[model samples]
Target chain A: MTEDKFKHEEDLFCSGHRACPGCGAALTSKLVTEATGPQTILSMPTGCMEVTTTPYPESAWGISWIHNIFENSAAVAGGIETAYRSFDKRNKEGYMNHEDVNFVVLAGDGATFDIGIRSLSGMMERGHDVLYICYDNEAYMNTGIQRSSSTPIGAATTTSPAGKESFGEDVHKKDMPSIAAAHGLEYVATASVAYPEDFKKKVEKALEIEGPKYIQIFAPCPRGWRHESKNSIEIARLVVETGLYPIFEMENGKITNVKKLKDRKPVEEYLKVQGRFKHLFEKEGGEEVLEELQKIADSNAEKIGIDKE
Target chain B: MTEDPYEDLKISKGAVVKPRTTLVNKTGSWRSEKPIIDHEKCIACGNCEKFCPDMAVKETEEGKFEIDLEYCKGCGICAEECPVKAIIMEEEEK
Candidate 1:
């Protein structure tokens, strides 16, 4: 239960910030920073999180945070980690200690999957001691809900409207976890805000690892998804329960763990909740798109071997 | 309020002199509604306390939940997710 996960006393993410009501990105950031503790430095790129949390004189983050351009968060984190290592070596007898400082990178899907992939790839290939977290809200939510590479198929957005000619986004969501795994990082995992325990454990585990670690969390956007604010966690849970978003972990290019669904629900149960997919149910020939999406889920289940149990 | 918002930029290249300074900014005016808890019907489930995105709900010394109106954005999430009907959202007073 979520109550069991809230035993910690210090909340690194305090109140009185400007996040929208029931934002999954805000919730995920809270859980992540709480698990990371006080001795951490975060590198955030230009995105919704950076804009909403840090508006001039106010900042929601309690840790040492630096905001960079949209595509260089990974690169900035690498520089920070390198500089900290050098300082730690030079100031062995100094008053300050910088040995156990954690370096993290937080960016949205638009930054990670589309514009910032090159820098991210370079960082992972070099094996920097940085934990990169991409809070996937499925599209460019900060910029008026525009379509991004991470946007799923048959989902409506400002750029990919479901009009007479187009059926929303034509392609599927990019496979980012697998792309990260291909870089042969020490740790890579997928998590959801609905499962706080699992998400916290992954954050803690990533902190323990030595080299580059990547965790992409499935964060739902209420304003962009056109769902009620209170249903954020519920929608996140349904996405996983329907096998649409597989929760898994990898170590050194091999799959180590997968969270299987005991009672898998139909994909329709997950799609019908969000207004982004509302057109699919209303328009003709939309059943084919749903069928295609279901097949993709089934294929994901088969590849992960999650349905065997 | 401080006259110069960029006063900190003169300290160093990228140093954050004052941490957690956001406490000074009062964001309560952003709310359109307010959540009021009925202490008589409260059960201290901690769900409201745990799930508040802003951390506006706190557990009192007597094990009761209290919403900090100064920070609560009237998301109504606490009332919507409350196990019991102890919490209700009323229109914010002008």
Candidate 2:
């Protein structure tokens, strides 16, 4: 067995918060907090994590945390970073060094891909030393699982339900990592909660850099995705193994590293496990939809040069 | 005593409250399934201790893994990751 790589000194994200059983977002938040450590201040937006973990008079956070509106976590984090920097300039001989502090914005897919994209883009453009992490659970799970732009094609969401005429969501998942890389950020990566070691390494690497960094972590939702709670990690791993989600890192708008799948599984293996895709199997003309999804995965594999012999 | 809810907001540093204050809320009742550790068959691999998202699994002084039921959400990641199959998830007794 591999050595325990994710061991940390503190449980920065403490238990007793009301995250659902087998919540990938909660787990990812914990892993991220552990990697960043106590010197960090987190700016969270309104979402499942924000609502669940932070009820009044009770908070799961062990570090300094601020909750912003749904669409302004990045902007708020930028403001906080500026405040710290301004204070540092005024107090040169002070006991604290502002450079030692880390500013982070943790938001969901709805905030990142849709509502808060403008502020996030602005933060990156202004070159704030903040790490913006989007825990992409696909749809808007907090707001009753509505279809967000990050929701993959053919997934049945509340807003885009499968009917006699429609076969679930029509649009594809947004290429958020590439979009972040396009902003010319110093660091951008995609990770999954299943791969804790890789996720931790990316978090640590993002903190070392001095500019804006974006990391979109694939956090599977058990309730939204309609999967057994125990199968969250299995589904997370399957998405990567089947080439549906490419785990890679970018530096200065260039792909610096890619985790290539040695033996790729068919996309069916992943789609078959989720309840959102159960309709795709039970309905007529569902195989065609599955083929189209496979094409998307295959194209991704080709684009990342993972399909090369 | 009905204290002002926004009293902390008046502070200079934007309300730096005490950390880990959530410890007051015991979430043990939230569990529908509970993880039972088989001590005799345990190898103390620490896989269960490491993968627990809640940090409810602890290593005792004797190096055996034990789950603190007060906080364990019973996600079963430990049972799934246990290399020795020493941990089992059973339905919580009502």
Clashes per candidate, residues 3 or more apart or on different chains: 0, 0
Candidate 1, A24-81: lDDT as tens digits: 8988888888789888999999999988878787777788899999999999999988
* DockQ versus reference, model 2: 0.35
Candidate number achieving the greatest DockQ relative to the actual structure: 2
lDDT of each: 0.85, 0.87
**Candidate 2 — which residues are off by over 4 angstroms?**
A1-10, A92-95, B1-17
Per-residue lDDT, model 1, residue B17, is: 34
Tens-place lDDT per residue, model 1, B55-94, is 7888876777888787777777788778888999899778
Fold similarity of candidate 1's chain A to the true chain A, as a TM-score: 0.95
Pairs of colliding residues, candidate 1: none
Docking class of 1: acceptable
Give DockQ for candidates 1 onward, in order: 0.32, 0.35
lDDT: worst 10-residue window of model 2 chain B:
B10-19
The DockQ-based CAPRI class assigned to model 2 is acceptable
Model 1, position A137: C-alpha lDDT score: 97
